[model samples]
Target: MPVGAQLLEGGRIRFRLWAPLAERVEVSLEEPGGTVHLPMEAREAGWYELSTDRARVGDLYRYRIDGVGEFPDPASRYNPLGVHGPSQLLDPGQFVWNDRNWRGRPWEEAVLYELHVGAFTPQGTFAAVRGRLDYLRELGVTAIQLLPVAAFAGAHNWGYDGVLPFAPAASYGHPDELKDLIQTAHHKGLMVLLDLACHYFGPEGNYLHLYAPAFFATDATGLAGRSIDAANPVVREFIIHNALYWLAEFHFDGLRLNAALLQEQAGQPDLLEALAHAVREGPGRERHCHLLLGHDRRAARYIHWHDHSVPRRYEAVWNDTAQQAVQEVLIGAGVAAVDRPLERLGACLSRGITAGGPDSLLPSAFVTFLQDHACIGNRALGERLHQLVSPRPLGAMVATTLLAPMPPALFMGEEFAATQPFLYFCDFNPDLIKKIAINRRKSFAHLPGFRTPKARARIPDPTHPATFARCQLDWNSVNHSPHADWLDFYRRLLAVRHRQITTRLAGMHEEAVQFTLPGEHGLSIRWTLGDDSVLTLLGNYGDLPLAGLQRPEGVVLWAEPGEAEHALNQGQLPPWSVVWLLRAAG
Candidate 1:
C-alpha cells in the first residue's frame, strides 16, 4: 500500500514509487489503445505519485525512471509476466473474503507443517494445494506454513530467491487463487502462514540499485546478496508495509520473517522492534497474528519472554539449535557433527538448548523440527533423515520433538516418510546457476565423501528439470508400505499433541522443566504445563535397548511400543523407542 499501485474509491488508480535519486519518474500504463506515459508529481521524501482514471485494475504497467528504461513496480501486487515483465494492477478489494469470522488460533495450538508450493502437489498451483487441505487437516497439523510465494525469476525455485515482495508467484496460480486457498484453509480450521524473505531481495530481478540505492545499506548478513537498509526509515516502512500487506490483504494467520536475525547482527534493531510494534498496533489487534523469527539463539533478545510467559516481541523462534541437537543425537558425529550430542539434546529438551542462560526463553517459545528445507535440501544429495538414520531411531527423534513442550513443524512430506528429496532447485541465469552449483559443492567439499570433484559432481544440478522434478511429493507412496504407517504415526502423535499438550502450553515456565538421562542413551524429561499437568517424554536414542529406567506415572499419550505399559513396567525401552505421558495435576 505504501509504494504500489492502489485502486482508489472513484475507480481511479493511484501509483506511487520512491525513487530518491531519480530526476523524473513516469507511470507507463499499458492501455488497450496504446501506451500512455504520465509524469508523476514529486512529493516530499523523494516520493513520486500519480492518480489517474486511465489506469484501472487488471492493466499491466511499469515505472520508467528518468526515461532510462521501464522496470516492474518494486511493490507490485501481481507480476503475471514474471519478474522481468510489467506489474499488473491488482485491486485488493476485488476478491470477496469469506474469512472475516476467522480470528485465527493461538500460537500454543500451532503444529506447523512447512511446505514449498511448487513441490507440494503435481499441479504446483494454489488450487492444487487447496485440494490437499483435507489431507493436511486430517494429518492433524494445526497450521500450514508455506515457503516464500513472492514472485521470483524462473519457473522453479525453493521460494527464497524472491524479487517481487508483494506479488504472489504466478507459477503458484493467480493472486486470487492464493487468497482462495487461504480462505479455504481457514474454513478447514487450519491456520496459514507465509514465510517472507524479509532480510534481502533476490539478486536477479531486483533493480533497486538503479533508481534507489538507499534501499540497501548493510552487509552484516552471511547471505549471498546485499542486505535491506533497515536503518533507513523509508526502507523500514517498505518492509513493514509489505508485512502488513500479506497479513491484512491476503489474510495469512502469521509470517515467518526469514533471515531477520541477520538484521539484528547488522545493528539495526530499530527496524525489527518498529515492525513488531507496527504489526501489533495494526493487523495484530484484530486477530492472532503470530510473528515468528527465523533466527537461532543469536536473536535471543528479540524473543525474550516476559513475566506473562510469552515473548516480549515475536511469538516464537525457529529453534535451529534444538534441531541441530536432535540431528546430533540421532546421527552423532556422522553427517553433521556435534560434541556431546546426548548432552546437547538434553540441554535443548530442558533449558540451555538456546544458549542455556538467564535470558533463555520458555520451551514453548521454540519451534522444533528434525528436518526442514535448509536441513535436507542443503545436502549434496538432499537425503532426508530417514535415509541417514534407521527407521526406529528416526521415529524416536520425531516423537521426541513433536511431543516436546515446544511447538513442532514437519517439513512437507516428512510425516509420510517421503523419499522425495527436497532439493535446492532454483531458476537463475546460466552464469548464476553455475555459480550456485560451484558454491554448493564448495560448501560440501569438506564433508567425508565429497572431497573429490567427482564425488561433488554426483550432487544434483539444481537447474536440471529432473532435479526439480525429483523433489515433487509422491502422493501414492503415502498409502504404500512404510509411508502409510509413517503417516499414521504422525497423525497419532499430532492428535495427542493438540488434544493434551497444546491446550496446556500456556504458562510454560522455563524453570519448571526437568531432564535426566535414564540410561547410556535414554532421555527422561518432564514439564509442568500451564494447567499443572505434568507432560513427560521418555526415549532411548541408541540402537540397543535402554534398560533399568523407572516407568513414569501418567496416561499414555503416544508410545512406539504397542504394549507400552508392559515395556515401561518392565523398566526397559526398546532400541530407538519413545513414550509420551501426561500426569493430571492433583
Candidate 2:
C-alpha cells in the first residue's frame, strides 16, 4: 500500500505510516465541526493504517504517536501553515493539469535557467512566476530548474533546509499553484526540473527522529544532522516514492539530486541509481524523465560511469571544474589557485573537465555554468560575476560558456547581469541564526578584504527578512542600456547554439570534438559533424590582441562586442574575446 494520506474512490481517504518505535498511532483529523481521533490498526513491519470516509481533500490532519502531541505527517502532501503546522490532505485528482501532451526535452537540447521562487520575483509565489514564463521562453532556455520547493520550518530559505520532502512550501502558495506553474511552463515549450536534497533533512521541525529513528544512519556524518539511512528499505521506498510523486503527481520533468556524493559516502545502496531506475522503468517512464547528479569536484566524473553490474544511470553531473576554470579566467588567475590555467580553461572549452581524462563523457553529459546560486550566494557576500569583472571580460565569459560543446545553465538574471546580491538567506530560529552568522563570518576570516571588522559587519544575517527582500531580482534592468546589451548577447548566443551547433553535434561520439591551444591565451575548438561540415570556435584570453592567427575559410557566426569583420579579416583575435566560425565541406 502507498504511504501518507491517499484519497481513494467514493470520497474515502487512507492513511499509512512506518513508525517502528510507536506501539500505537492515531490519525487526528481537524474537521470544521470538531477534532476527530481515530485509532489506526497496526500492520506488519511496524506500519500503521487508517481509513475514514469523514476525511476528504482539504482536511487538516496530523499523526499522534501513543497519545503524544500531534506532529505533521512524514509523507505529507501539503503543509498549509508550514512544516511545524498540521498537514493538509491534497487529492492529486482534484487539480486540473493541462500538460498532458508534454513529453519533455532531451538533456543535450536543454538550456537550463535556474531560479529560486522567493528571490526570482517580488511576489515570490508560484503564481507570480507564471507571469515570467514568456520571458524565459524568449531567453531561449528549454528548461527552468527551480530551487527546492519542499516544505521547511520557516517562511524563507534557500530550499535546502526543507524537512518535508513530499510537501511543497506553503509560503510559495498552494500545491496546485506549483502544478499551475509547471503546466504553464510546458505550454510554453519549457521543461521544469526540480532540485532535491536527499543527503539530509533540515534540523527545524524534523519529526523523523521522533518516530522512526532507524530512518537515520547512526554512523552518518554531516552538518545537516544525521544522514538518511539509505540501507533501510522503508527509507529507500520513502525516497523513491517521493521522486516519483513529484514526477507523476506534480508533473516535474526531471530532478537535480543536490549533493549526491553524500549518498555515495554513506556506504548504502545507491539511491541516485534507484531514482534513475524508478524514473526510467517505473510509472514515470511515459514522461521523458531526466536525472542530474549534483556532486562536488571529486565525484563529478561518475556521470559517465557505466558499469554493467549497476543498472542506474544519470544524464549529467554539475561540472564544478569547468565552472571554476571559467570563473578563474574571467575574474583573473589569482582568483583561484589553478595550475596550468590556460590548459585548464582550454580543456573546459574543448572537453568538460581537465582531470576527467580521455574516458570522460561528452560535453553534453556535463552541465556547465559560470554563476550558479551556490557560486554567487554561498559566499560571505553574495557577489555576481559582473561585480567581480568588467563588462567586456564578462561578455567574453558569457560567450565562452554558451559556445562551449556542453549544455549551459544560467542563473536567474544572469543574462541581464542583475546587480542584486544573491546572499545566503534563511529563516531559522534565533539560536541557529546566531550559529549560522558566526560560522559565515569565520569562513571569510582568511580573505584579505573580509578580514577587517567593517567587512565582517557587512555580512547579512541569514534570518533577516531584509536580506531575502534584497535578493529579489530587479526585472526593470532588462530594458536598461548595458543590461540590455548583456541580454541581447545571451539571446544571440543561444540562437546560434540551437540553429547552428546543437543538431549537428547531437549524436556524435565524444572524440569527434577536438580542442587545442594555439597560444598561451588562445584556444581553438573544432567539432566535426557527420555531414562533413565543421564548426570552430576561437577564443583569446589575453589583454593584448592575438596576432598571426590562422583564420578558417568559413562564415563568421559571431565575434566579440567591438571586433567582428575587421578582426576576422585582419587575422587578429581581440583580447578577451570569442569568435565562432563554420566551414562547409564541398
Candidate 3:
C-alpha cells in the first residue's frame, strides 16, 4: 500500500515510487494513442506520486527516473511480459473465488507435499497443477506447499531467484489462473501454501540497486551478496506487504518462509519478528494461516522460544536437523553414541533439534521431511533419497518420519519414486549463466565425484536446457510395476497416519514420550497419547535381524514386511523393518 500502482475508486490509478537517489521521476503509461509521460509530484522523504484518470486497468506502465531509462514497477502485481519488460495493471477483485468459507485445515492434519509449479507437470502451469488435485487428495495429501512462483528472469527456475516479490510468474499463466488453482485446491479440502524468499533479490532483472542502493545492506551473505536492508522502514514494509499480498490477494492458506540471505541471522531478529507480527495482526486473524520458518540450521527460537500472546510465533520450523541426522544414520556418519541412528534421532525426539536444543518444544513443533528441493537439488547429481539409499533403510525412514509426532512433508516426486533429478537449474542472463554453471560445479568441489575439473565438468551444466528438462516428472511411469508399488506404500502410510496418528497428536509433547535404542541399529520409541493411550514404534535399520527385543504391548497398527505378529512372537525385528502399535486407553 505504501508504494507501487494502486487503483482508486472512480477508475483513476494512483502511482507511487520511492527513489531517493533520483531528483525526479515520471510515469510512462502506454496508451492506444501513444505513450503518455506524467510528471509526478515530489513528496516528502524520497517519494514520488501521481493520480490520473488517463490510466486504467490492463494498461502497460513503467517508471522512468530523470529521463534516464524506464523500468518495470518494483511492486508490480503482474508482469505478463516478463521481469525485464513493462508491468501490467491487474485488479485483484476481478477473479471470483468460490471457496469463501474455506477456513483451512489444522496443522496437525497436514500431509504436506512440496512442489515446484514449473516442474510439477510437463505443462508447468497453475491450471496443470489444479488438474492434479483429485490425484493428490486420493493420495491422502491435505496441503500442497508450492515452491516460490514469484517472477524470476527466465521461463525456468526453482524460484529462489525471484526478483519481483509480488508478481506471479508470466510463465505460469495469468494471476487469475494461480488464484483458480488455489481456489480449486481449497474446494477440494486441500490447503495451498507458498514458499517465499525474504532477505534478498536474485542476481538479474533487479533495477532497485541502480536507483535505491539503500535498499540493500552492506552484507555479504545474500544470494548474490546483496542482503536486504531490513532496518529501513520501507524495505521492512515491502517484505511485510509481500507476505500479506500473497495471503490476502492470492488466498494461500499459509507460507513457508525461507530467510536464506545469510548463514547467521540469529542475532538480528527485528525484521523477522516484525514481519511475523504484521501477519499475525493481518490476514492471520481471519483463518488458520500457519507460518513455518526455514533457517540455515534447525532453528527454533522463532517457533518455540517466543510468547504466544497473539499467535505471533511460527507454528514450526523445517526440521532439517532430524532429516540430516536420519541421513547420517543411513550413511553411518555420526560417531560416539549408544546406537547408530537412534543416538541422533533420540536427541531430536527427546530434546528439540533447535540451534540450542530447547527441551520445552514439542516434536510437533517441527516439520520433518526426508527430501526437499534444497537437499535434492544441492547434491552433485541432484539425487533423491531413494536413489542414494537402499529401499529397506529408506522405508524405515519413511515410517519414522510420517508416524512420528511431528508433521511430515514430501517432495513432489518422492511419493511415487519418480526418478527424475530435481536439479539446480536457472535461466540467468547470458553473461551470468556461465558463471552460475561454473559455481554450481565448484560448490560441489568437496564431493568425491567433483574432486577434479573433468569430473566437475560432468556435474551437469545447470545452464543447459537438457539439465532442466532432465528434472521433469515422468507421469507415464507411475502406473508401472515398481513405481506403482511405491505409490501404494506412500498412500497406505499416509492413510494410516491420518486415521490413527494425527488425531492423537494434539496434546503430545517431549515429556510424554520415551525411547530405547536396544542394539546397534535398533530404535524403540513410544508416545503417551492422551486418555492414557500409548503409541509405540519398533524399528530395525540394519542388514541382520535384531533379536531378544521385548514385544510391545498393543494392537498392531502398521508393519513393514507385513509380519508384526511373526516378528513379535519371535521376540525380534526383521532387518530394515518398522512396526507401529497402539495401546488404547482404559
Best TM-score among the predictions, by candidate number: 1
lDDT of each: 0.84, 0.81, 0.82
Ranking by TM-score: 1, 3, 2
By lDDT, rank the candidates, best first: 1, 3, 2
Candidate 2 CA-lDDT value: 0.81
In candidate 2 the C-alpha lDDT for residue 173 amounts to 94
Q: Model 3: per-residue lDDT, tens digit, 222-306?
A: 2374668876778878888888899989999999887552234565657667777788788888888888888445356667633
Query: Model 2 clash tally?
Result: 0
Q: Assess every candidate by TM-score.
A: 0.95, 0.94, 0.95
Q: lDDT tens string, model 1, 1-586?
A: 8788988898999999999999999999888888889999999989999999988778999999988889999899999989999999988888999889999997888899999999999889999999999999999887999999999889989887788889999989899999999999999999999998866777678876678878887443223656687778888889899999999999999999865524545554677777788888899898888888885565556677677454567887787777777888877754457677787787777764446334446876778888899999877899989989888778778888888888899999999889899888888877678887778778888888999999999988887788899999989898898999999999988888878888898877778888888778888889888889998888888878888888888998888765545687799888878888899998
Runs with alpha carbons beyond 4 Å of true place in candidate 3: 219-225, 260-269, 296-298, 305-312, 333-341
Model 2 lDDT per residue over 1-586, tens place: 2789988888899999888999999999898788888999999989999888988788899999999778899889889888888999887888888778888876667899999998999999999998999999989999999999999878899988788899999999998999999999999999999998765788787887888889987643323556687778888888888888988888998888865433555556776667777788965567678788784554454466343112147777777777777777776544456776667766765566556344445667778898899889866779888988988878877887786667899999999989999998888777687887777777787888798878888888877899999999999888998889889889999998888777665554567677788777888888765356787888888788887788877888778765644786787788888888888856
Candidate 3 least-lDDT 10 residues: 333-342
Task: Give the candidate number with the greatest lDDT.
Answer: 1
